[model samples]
Target: MYRIIGIIVTLLFIMSILLAALALLVSRISLNRHVWLAGFFAGILDFFYMPLKYFFYKFSDPRILDKWMVSLKNISNRNSFKKADRRMIIAPHCMRHMECPASSKRTGIQCVSCGKCIFSRLREDASKYGYDLYIVTGSSFVKHVIKEKSYDAALLIACDYELNKVMMGLKGKRLITYGVPMLNDGCFNTEVEYEKVIETLELFSN
Candidate 1:
């Protein structure tokens, strides 16, 4: 029995390594017209996500791999995300300024547009696009918000680790999620690529 378990574990290990390698190769080489191939590779990578995260976290940014998977998902599910009946933007509170004046509420941070942080601009853009914006402190808070609200699609911004965790949690939900990695990841003063965020929002809104 022990030997059988050992062989299974060995095969799983080998398969994960191969899948990780293929994911990286396809991402860097631009599979282009073969969008199906990219989607298939991404699905397998997500299935073996934990092992991949452990391996990548040791030597490189796991968020890069996560972002590649998200790109593949976006390519395959473009219409589904774009035409969703409801849309929302969920950002991290850490992106706020050190002296932010926003107050935390049951829904999330209520940004008064005090011009104290990035949330001011992000909130404005979200409103312009008719999206519900929520700046959350952590994954648990995000879960609570999702449970109480109903949105078919969500654009999430966070550090790589938090993004990965939230993506895993969102697996069984009926919502589609697109993640934007932060420019700098930490407990305070985090930032994201505003252009990328805007581009994603435009894609979904239009």
Candidate 2:
């Protein structure tokens, strides 16, 4: 499956980044050795990474992304000439309603729902773009939300492993998904990048 392949690729990428970073951290002749070693390994990936991804994607669940995209197109057409202004963003981190999904939550943990997480920002972006987006807080409840009414697209901010599982069950849904891998499996360890989501949404929406 593509998930298996993706994990391997991601690991390789991570490895390269670590190697290059360590090399940069060293100094002098030792630094030169580090740089040469890191560059050699990183080069192997740098040269073939994109092409490998292309192949992997080609071999992935062929119809899943297609279907999700189609659904979005349908929603867009439904509101043709009309501005789409709704949202279905997911914020897995609801410190108020529930404890942080994962990790350690101390006395300082708080969730004012000020649209701080990727969940809130994505929702805002969805409304701005005139499409409904779902913020799936829990993977256990994913089936329920996914089967709900016609959503234009989905923005999944979950662990890399969970994303792979989610994709495993999904058939060609014509979706343009942005899988955000959290630092840890749950809210406690979860960290989000609002700017990245914004950038991705801009690319996906367009």
Candidate 3:
């Protein structure tokens, strides 16, 4: 019995190592081209994410892991996101203008399109594309948004860390998410490429 247990443990350890290696490879390669087993590799990375993040945190840039994971997930979710009839855009409050006059509620920020921030343009585009826009303060507000209405897909905009964080949080909620990472990270005045946002909306628009 002891010998059998030892053999099983050895095999499990080896399998874990191989899966982690494959996941890393897929992440790196997906940056340039489409990957075949994107969903599988993404699952592997998600399973090992905490440990891998700690490893990167100690010796390397953890943001790279988040960026790669976001890419892989986007590839995995593309088809389904495109097919989703009900979609929403979840944006971060940090991207709003400093003197912006948006109000905070349980659902999220209500953008009045006052022309002081990118959100004005985003709200217009979101309406044009038939996507509900939620300008959230943080990740925790996602649950409230989820409860507020029914959505089959979500287009997320944030830094890589927050994008990956929200993606993982929404993993089992029966929602498909595609992340567009922002140009920079900060508490306020962060920015994203407007063209990229519009491109994503147009690509997946029904």
Candidate 2's TM-score reads 0.43
Please give, for residues 1-206, the per-residue lDDT of candidate 2 as tens digits.
Answer: 99999999999889866664442233123312322343243234334435534644887642333232222222322222122222234345431234323232221222334544544455556678655554444555656665665554455555554553453344255443345445555555466566765664565453
| Residue-wise C-alpha lDDT for candidate 3, range 30-107, written one tens digit per residue | 989999989889999999999999999999999999999999999999999999998899999999988888789998
lDDT of 1 by residue, 120-182 (tens): 898889989988899888888887778767889878888766775776688769888777778
CA lDDT, every prediction? 0.78, 0.45, 0.95
Q: 2 or 3: which has the higher lDDT?
A: 3
RMSD to true structure for each model, in Å: 3.2, 15.3, 0.9
> How many Å off is the CA of 81 in candidate 2?
21
lDDT: worst 10-residue window of model 1: 27-36
**Model 2 poorest 10 in a row by lDDT:** 102-111
TM-score (C-alpha, index-matched) for candidate 3? 0.97
Q: Sort by TM-score, best first: what order?
A: 3, 1, 2
